[model samples]
Target chain A: MPTLSIAELKKQANLIRQDIILMLERAGSGHPSGALGMADIFAVLYFQILNHTPHKPNSPLRDRLILSCGHYCPVLYATLARAGYFPLVELKTLRQINSRLQGHPHNLSLPGVENSSGPLGQGISQAVGMALAGKIDQAKHQIFCITSDAEHNEGQLWEAIMTANKYQLNNLINIVDCNNIQIDGKTTDIMPLLSLRKKYESFGWKVLEMNGHNYGNIIATIKQAKNYQKGPVVILAHTIPGKGVSFMENKYDWHGKAPNKEQAEKALQELRQAV
Target chain B: MPKENKNKSTRDGFGDALLALAKKDKNIVVVSADLAESTRVWKFAKKYPARFIEVGVAEQNMLGIAAGLALADKIPIATSFAVFSPGRNWDQLRISVCYSKANVKIIGSHTGLGAGEDGASHQALEDIAITRCLPNLVVLAPADYNEAQKALAVAIKHQGPIYLRLTRQNTPIFTSAKSIFKIGQANILQKGQDVTLIACGALVYDALQVAKKLATQNISVEVINCHTIKPLDKKTILASVKKTKKVVTLEDHQIHGGLGSAVAELLAENYPVPVKIMGVNDTFGESGTPEKLYKKYGLDQEHIIKNIKEII
Candidate 1:
C-alpha cells in the first residue's frame, strides 16, 4: 500500500469523522466528543503512520495500536472498519448485545485491537508493554497508544508514564487528546493537569505538541516521533472536545451522548463542510 | 526421619533459570522493581542488559512495563516481592497481563511469611488467592529451587499470563534437578494411604518431612507437592482423597484463600473429605525470623504433623 499524503490523510480523516457520526447515530449510545476529537490522529495512524495490514490483524510484524481511552472507541472502530479490518457494516452493531464490537475496546473480541481498554489509565500501560515487547523481540514495529487527556487524572496513567520513561521505550508513541472537557466539567476545575508535556519530559519522554485536528501537523509529529530514537514519545495534541460539529464541538454534554437521527444528519452535514 | 536438609531459596532457582533462559532465548526479558539482588532477577539483568528493565520501586509500573514488553512478543519476567506484585499492583496485573492474556511472567519474590523480618507488610499471604481468582492467569507457587527453575522455564514456554510465586528465605530442596515439572500436575513426593498432605511453596518440604515422620509411626501419609495453585491438580487430589479420607493442606500463605482454601473448595465440591488447613490462620505475622514465624504460625514439619493428626 502506498503511503497516504497529507492531503489524502485529511480526506480520510473527514471520511472517518463521517463514519464516527453515522456509527454513533446508529448505536444511539456512544461517545462523540472525544471520538471526533481523535479523528485526525486516527486517520494519520491508520492510513500512513502505522505499518499494518487489515487482512492480517495479528501479524507479529505489524505495528500495534491500543485505544486506551476506550470510551472514544467509536473513532477507533470507525477507523479500523474503514481501513478494511472488518466490514464497515460491523460498525452498526457496535455496543449492541452479543456484538463483537463492545463499548470498550476488547483485544480478544476484536481483531486489530492490541489491548482491551475500558477503565481509565490502562491502555497506555498495555501499550507500554507492547512497545517493550517489540523492543525485546527486535521488531521494527512500533506501538501507537491513543489516550484521552482527561484520563491523566488517573494515577495509573502516571505510573505508566514513569515506566515508559524508565525503560527508555523509544518504540512507544503515546498520543493524548487534550480537549480539556471531562465528564463533570472543565478539566481545570475538576483536576488541573498543570503541565503534561513537562511532566512527561521530566519522566524522560520525548515530548511533541501538535494541533490534533490538523492533518499536516499530525503527520509531521508522527514522523518526528519516528525519528526520535532516545526514549518514548508523547504527543500532547490540543484538540476541541467535540471537534467538527458546531453544536457538539467543545460541549461537555456530548462527551458520551449519542446523536439522534435528526442530530446525526446535522452533525454529518456540519462535519462534511467544515473538514 | 532426617530433619536437616540442604536449604536453597526458590528465588535462587528463578535467578539461575532466568539467566539460563536468557542464554537460550534472548527474547526472555526480566524487569525488576529495585529488588534485583533480592528477587535474584539481577543475574539475568547483569548478563542481558537489553532484555532487563529496572522500573525502580514501582510494582505497578513493573507490571505495566512487563505487559507492554509481552505485547510486543517478548517473554518478560517481572520480579518483585510477592507482597507488591499481587498485593500492590494487582489491578495492573489483571488488566494488562491476565485480562489481555499477554505472554508475561509475573514473578513475586519473598512471598508469604518466608519473607521473614519484612513482616506482614512484605509477607504476601494473599498472593495465591488473589492471583488464582483472576481468570486465564497461571498461578504457580513452586516448592523448592529445582521446581522454581522448572516453573520459570515452564512459564517462558507457555503463551499466556503466569505468576511464579517465590520465597525469600532458603528452604529445603525437595525435588532433584532431573525431576520432570509440568504445570497443573501435582508432584507426589511421598506415597502412602493413611491420609493425604497437599502443600505448596516452602511448606511442601515441611509436608514431606511430616509425611516421613508419620511413616515411622506406622501411619502412612501421602505427601503431594501442589505446585501450581491456580490449575489445582484435582485428579491427584481426588485420587489421594479416595485412599485417605482426611486431607492436611500446608502453605506459607494465609490459610483462608491460599492452597488450603483452594484444596478445601475442590474437596468440598467433589470429594467432601475432612481437611485441616495449616498456614497463617487469619492473622498478620510480625517482624520475626522465618524459622520462628513458621513454628509460631504452625507451618513447620511439626505443625504439619500436628495438623495431619488433627485431620486424621
Candidate 2:
C-alpha cells in the first residue's frame, strides 16, 4: 500500500476514533481514553510507517507492531480493519463471545496482533526479544513496541529497557503513549513517573519526544528513530486521554470505561463535524 | 543397574543439550536471567556469545523476551531458578509464552527441596503444580541427567512451550543414557507386584533405593519415572496401580500439586487405591544439609519406604 499523506492520515485517524467510539458503545465495556487518544499514531503506523501487508500479517519481512497497552486494542482493531486485515464488521463484535477482536489483543486469535497483552509491562520485553532476533538474523524489519504511561510503573518494563540497551537494539523503537491520565486518577496522582525522558536516557536509550496526535510529528519522530543506530530509541509520544470528543478529552474518567449509547452518538457527531 | 554410574547434576545435562541444540540449529538461542552459571545455560552463552541474551536478574522480562524471540521464529531457551521463573513469573509464562504458544523452552533449575543450604527461599516446591495448570504448556520433571537431556531435546523439537524442572545438586543417575524419551510417556524403571513407587525429579533415585530395600523383605515393588508432569501419563500410572493395588508417590516438592497429587488425582477418579503421598508437607523449608532437609521434610528414602510400607 502507498503511504497516506499527512492530511489523509488525519482523516484516517479521525475515522478510527469514530470506530473506537462505535465499537466501545456496542461492546458495553472497554477502555476508551487511550484507544481514542492513540488513534493518529496507529493510523500513521499501520498506514504510513509499518512495512506490513494486511493480507499476510505474519510475513517475516514485515515490521512487528506490538501493542503493549492492550486496553487500547479497540484502536488497534479499528486500524487493522481499516488497513484490510479483517472485515470492518468484525469491529462490532468487540468483546463478544469467540470474537477475534478481544478486549485485550491475542496474537493467536487475531492475525495482525504481534503479541498478546492484558497484564501490562510485558509487551516491551517481548518487543525487545523480537528486535534482538531481527538483529541476529540481519533482518531489515523494525520492531515497534507501543506502550502507555501508567505502565512504566511495571519494573519489568525498565528491565526490558536495560536489556534492549545492553543488546544495542537499533531496530527497536518504543513509542510510549505518554497521556497523563490513568485509571483511578492522574498518572501523577496514582503513580508519579515525573520525567519518562530522563528515565529512558538513564537506561542508555536515545530518547525522542513527539506529539502523538499530530500525523506529521508522529511520522517524523518515527523516521528519526528508524535512523538512530547508537542504541534503542524511545519516542515519548504525548497524547490527550480522549483526543477528539470535547467532554472526554484529557479526562481520566474516560480512562477505563466505554461511552454509553448517547455519549457515543454525541462523540460520533462531534467527530464527523470536526473531520 | 549400570556398572559405571557417573553422578552428575541434572543441570549439566540441561547445559549440554542447550549447547548441542544451538550447534545444530542457529535458531536455538539461550536467554539467561542472572542465574546462567547456576542453571548451566552459561555453557551455551560461552559457546555462542551472540546467541546468548543476558537479561540480568529479571525473570519476568527474560520470559517476555523469550516469547518475543519465538515470535521471530527463533527457538529460545529461557533459564532461571525454578523458584523465580515459574514461581514469580507465572503471569509472564501464562500470557507471553503459553498463551502465545511461543516455542520457548523454560529451564527452571535448582528446583525441589534438594538445592541444599540456600533454604526455602531458593528452593522451588510448587513449579510443577503452577506450570501444569497452564494451557498450551509442556511440564517435564526429568528423573536424572540422561532423562533431562532427552526431555530438553524433545521439548526443543516440539512446536510450542515446554517447562523443564532441573536440579542443582549432583543426583544419582539411574536411567540409562540410551533411554528413549517421548512427551507424556512414563518409563517403568523397575517392575514388581505388591506395590508401585511412582516418582519424579531427584526423588526418583530415592524411590529406587526405597524399592531396593523393600525387595529384601520379599515385597515386590514397581518403580515408575513420571517425568512428564502436566499430561500425567495416566496409562502407565493406572496400569501400575492396577497390578500393585498400593501406591506411594514421591518427590522433592510439596505433597500438593506435584507428582504425588497428579497420581492421587488420577487414581482417585479412575481406579480407587490406597495412595500415600511422600513429600514436603504444606510448609516452608529451612536452611540445612540436603540429608537433614530431606529427613526433616519426609522426602528421603527412609520416608518413602515408610510411606510405602504403611500403604502396602
Candidate 3:
C-alpha cells in the first residue's frame, strides 16, 4: 500500500466530519458526539487501511468492519456512501421508515455492514469469532471492531477480550472511541476507566494509544497494530466528544442528540474551514 | 409387546450423537460451561479436542460466545445444565441467538428432576417455559437414548435456534434409532379415543406407562410426545383432542408456562377441551432424588394414571 501524507489524511477526515453532520441533519435523529469523535479513525480505516470493494460488498475475502457502538451508525452509513459502497443519495433515507439505513447497521439489509449489531458488547465478540473463523478457514482477511469507550464497561466485553486473547486472534483489531462522553454523563465522572491501554495490555492484547483526532497517528498506529502476530490488538484513540463543532465538543448533551439544520450548517462550515 | 424398554441417560445420547456429528462435519463445535463431564460434552472433547470450547461455568458468556460462533457460520452445540442455560442465561439466548436468529443449538443437560441427586440448583424445571416463549426457537425433549440421538441429528440440521433439553437419570429407551424424528411434529405412540395424554422430556415415558395402566380399566388414552414445543404440533394435538374431548397434559416442569400450559393454551383457542394439567403446580423445587422429587411434585407415572382416571 502506498503511504498517505498527514495533510491528505486530515483533509479526508474533515470531509468525513462534514458528511456526518449532514447525514445526522437529514436523518433528524442520531448520535453526533461519538460519530464526530470517530471521524478521523473511520477515515483512516475506510480510505487507507481497510481492504474492501465498494462494488462487491459481500466478497468473501473482504475485511470485516463491525460497529459495536451502534448508535453512531450515521458515521458508518455516511462513510460507506462516500466510499462508493452505495449511492450518496441513499444517505437521505437514513432512519426513515423502511429505510435500508436503519439506526443500527443490519448486515444483509445494508451494503457494507458485515453483521447486525445494536446490543452492545456482542459485536466485538462476534468480530472475535469472525477473526477466529478466518484463522480456522485460513483466510487472510482482518476483522476490525469499533467500540465506544463507555461500551467497554459491559461484562460481555471482557468475555470477548478474554476469548480473543485465549485464541491468540492476531487478525482482530479494535478501535475504541475514547471521547469520554456517554449517554448519562462523562465516562470518567460516571465510572472512571482510569487507563484503558493498560487494561488491554493486562488482558494479553497488543495495545496502541494515539490521538484519535490526528489522522496520521490513527493510520500509523493502526498499521502497527495490524503488524503484530501474537494476539488481538486495540487502538485506544483519544478524541473530543465532538471534534469540529465548537458548542458540542466535550459536551455530553450531544452524545445521542442530532444537530438541527442551523447547527448542521455551522458544523459543516467549521469542518470546511478546518479542511 | 409389554412396552420394550431399557435404562440410559439422555445426556449420553447427546454425547454419542455429538461425537458422531463432528466426525461427519468438522463444522460441528461443542462449547461447555465447565460441565463437560456432567453434560457429557467431555466425550466430544476427548475425541475432537479442536472442536470443543470449555468456558468454565460462565453461562451468560457461554451463550454469547455460542451466538458469535453461529454468526461465523459454525454449528455450535453449547452444552450446560438446563437450570443454567435457559434458567440463568435466557436473556443472552433470547437476544443474541433467537432474536438474531443464529444457528446455535443449546443442549440443556439434566432437564427436569430426572437429573436425580443434583437436586433443585442443577435440575431445570422452567427451561421449557423459558425457551418455548422465544420466537424462532425450537424446543426438543427426547424420551430416551435412541430418541435423543435422532433428535440431536434433527436439531443440527434445523435452521435457526433449537434447545435440546436432556436428562441425567437413566430412563427407558422406548423408541429405536429407526423411529422417525421430525422437528415441530409430534409422534403419537398410542391411539385412543377416551382421553389424550400429551407429554414431553422424561415424563413422556411415564405418560406411556400410565396409558398402559389405563387401557386395562377400559379407559383408552392417546399418548403424544410433543418434542417441539414452540411450533407446538397443534395439528396433531387438535386431531387427538377431536377424538378425545378430555385432555390430560403431563410434564416435569411447572404447569404454568411449561408443557401443560402450552397445551392448555392451544386447546383453549383451537378446540376448548376439558384439560387437567399434571406437573409441578406453581412452586420451586428442592433437594431430593429424581424419583422422590417426581413423586412429591405429582410428575410420576402414578400421578399420571390417577390424573387420567379423574379426567376420564
Candidate 4:
C-alpha cells in the first residue's frame, strides 16, 4: 500500500472536523470535545492506516475498527461518510428516532461499524475476540479498538487487556484518546488515569505515545504498531479535548455539550482556515 | 413404559453434545471462564484445544469474546456457572450479544440448588427471570441429560442468542434419544384432565414421580415438560390448563421468576386457572446435598403431590 502524503491527510482531517461540528450542531445534542479531538486519528485511520474498503464493509478480509467510546460517534459517522460508506447527507439524521446513525455506534444499523457500542470498555473485549479469531484463522486482517481515557476506569477494560496479552494478540491495536476531559470534569479529577503508558506496558502490551492531532505522528505510530508482533499494542495519543476551535479547546465543559449555531459557524471557520 | 432411566448431570450432556457438534461443524467453538471441568466444557477443550478459549475467570470478557466470534460467523458456546454468566455478566449478554443479535450460545451450568455444596453464591436461581426478560434471547432449562443434549443442538441451530441452563446433580434422564426436541415446543409426557403439572429443568422428574403417586389416589394428572422458558409453549400450556382448570408449576429455581412465575403470568392473562407454584419461596439455598436442598426448598416429589391436592 502506498503511503498517503501527510498534507493530503491533514486536509482530510480538517474536513472531518468541520463535518463533526456541522453534524453535532444539526443533531442539537452530541459530544464535541472528544469527537473534535479524534479527527486527525480518524482521518489517518480511514484514509491512510486501516486496511478497509467502504464498498465492501462486510468483506471477510477487511480490517475491523471498533469504537469503545461510542459517545463520540459523530467523528466516526463523518469519517465513514467521507470514506463513502454512506452519503454525507445522511449525517443530518444522526440521533433521529429512526436514523441508522444512532447516538452511539450500532453495528447492525450501520454497515461500516464493526460492533455496536454504547457502554464503555466492552468494545475492547469484542475486538480481542475478533483478533483472536483472526489468529485462529491465520488471517492477515487487523482489529483496531478506539477507547477513551475516561473509559479505562471500567474494570472490564483491564480484563480485556489481560486477555489480549494472554492470547498474545499481536493483530489487535488499541488507541486511547487521551484528551483528559470527561463528562463531569478532567479525567484526573474524575478518576485520575495518570501513568497511562506504564499501565499498558505493565499489562505486557507494546505502548506507543503520540500526538493525536498530528496526522504524521498518528500514521507513523500505527505503522510502528503493525510491525510489533510480540503482543497487543496500545497507542496513547495525547490530544486537546477540542483541537480546532479556540474557545472549546481543552475545556471540560465542551466534553459532551454540542456547539450552538453561532459556535458551529465559528468552529467551521477555524477548521476551514486550518486546512 | 419409560425406558431404563440413566443418571447423569445435565452439564455432562452439554459437554458431550458440544463435542459432537464441533466435530460436524468446525465453526463450533467453546469459550470458558475458568469452569471447564465444573461446567463440563473440558471435554471439548481436551478434544479440540485450538477451538477452545480459556478467558480465565472473566465472565464479562467471555461473553464479549463469544459475541465477537459469533459476529465473525463462528458458533461460540460460552460456558460458566449460572450465577456468573447470566448473573454476573448479564449486562454484557444483554448489550454485547442480545442487543447486537450475535449468534452466541451461553451455557450456565450448576443452576438452582442443584449446585449444592457450593452454597447460595454459586447457585443461579434468578437466571431464568433475568434471561427471559431480554428480547431476542431464547432461554431453555432442559429437564435431564437427554433433553439437555438435544436442547444444545436446537440452540446451536438457532440464529440468535440462547441461554441453556443446566444442573450439577446427576438427575434422572427420562427423555429418550428418540424424543423429538424443538426450540419453543413443549413435550407432553402424560395426558390427564383432573390437574396439570408444568415443570422444567431437574424438577420435571419430580413432577413425574408425583404424577404416579397422584394416579393411585384417583387424581388424574397431566405432565408437560416446558424446556423453553422464553417463547413459552402457549398452545400446549393453554390446552392443558383449559381442561384441568387446576395447575401446579414446579422448578429448581425461585418461585418468583422461574417456571412458576412464567406459568402464572401466562395463566393469569390467558386461562386464569387456580395455579400453585411449588419452588424455593423467596429465599436462598444453603450448603447441603441436592436431595436435602430439594426437600427443604419444597421442590421434592412430596411437595408437588401435596400442592396438587391443595390446588385441586
Off by over 4 Å in 3: A1-12, B1-5
Q: What are the TM-scores, per candidate, against the unseen true structure?
A: 0.93, 0.98, 0.94, 0.98
CA-based DockQ, model 4: 0.78
lDDT of 1 at A253: 92
Q: What's the true lDDT of residue A140 in model 1?
A: 88
Number of the top-ranking candidate, with TM-score as the measure = 2
Query: Can you write out model 3's per-residue Cα lDDT over B1-312, one digit (the tens) per residue?
Result: 235666888889889888888899988888888899988888889988877776766777788777767877889888888888877777678767886788899999877777767667777778888888898899888888888999999988987899998989888888767878998889898999899989888778888888888889898999999877878898999989999999998888878788888898988888897999887888877878888898988888887888888887
Model 1 residue pairs with clashes: A128-B68, A129-B67, A129-B68, A129-B69, A130-B68, A133-B69, A134-B72, A242-A250
User: lDDT per residue, candidate 2, B1-312, as tens digits?
Assistant: 764377888999888877777788989998898888888877777789999889999999999999999999999999999999988899999999999999999989888778888988998988888998899998999988888889888998899999999998987777888878989999898999999888888888888877789899988999998989878889988888899899888888888888888888899899998988888899988888878899888877777777777877
Give candidate 4 misplaced runs (Cα > 4 Å): A1-4
Q: What is the DockQ of each candidate?
A: 0.64, 0.93, 0.47, 0.78
Candidate 1 lDDT over residue span B1-312, tens digit each: 233458889999888888888888877878888988998876677778877887678787778777777777688888888888878888888777788898888888888888889778988888988999999998998888888999998988999999999998887776878788999999888889889888888877777777767878988998899999889999999999999899888888888888889999998999897888888889998889999988898777776777777777
Q: Could you arrange the candidates by TM-score from highest to lowest? A: 2, 4, 3, 1
lDDT of 2 by residue, A209-251 (tens): 9988777788889999999989899999999989999999999
Point out the worst 10-residue segment of candidate 1 chain A by lDDT: A129-138
Cα error, candidate 3, residue B172 (Å): 0.8
Cα lDDT for residue A6, model 2?
Answer: 85
Model 2 CA deviation exceeding 4 Å by range = none
Candidate 3 chain A weakest ten by summed lDDT:
A1-10
lDDT of 3 at A188: 84
Instruction: Rank all candidate structures by their DockQ, best first, as comma-separated numbers.
Output: 2, 4, 1, 3
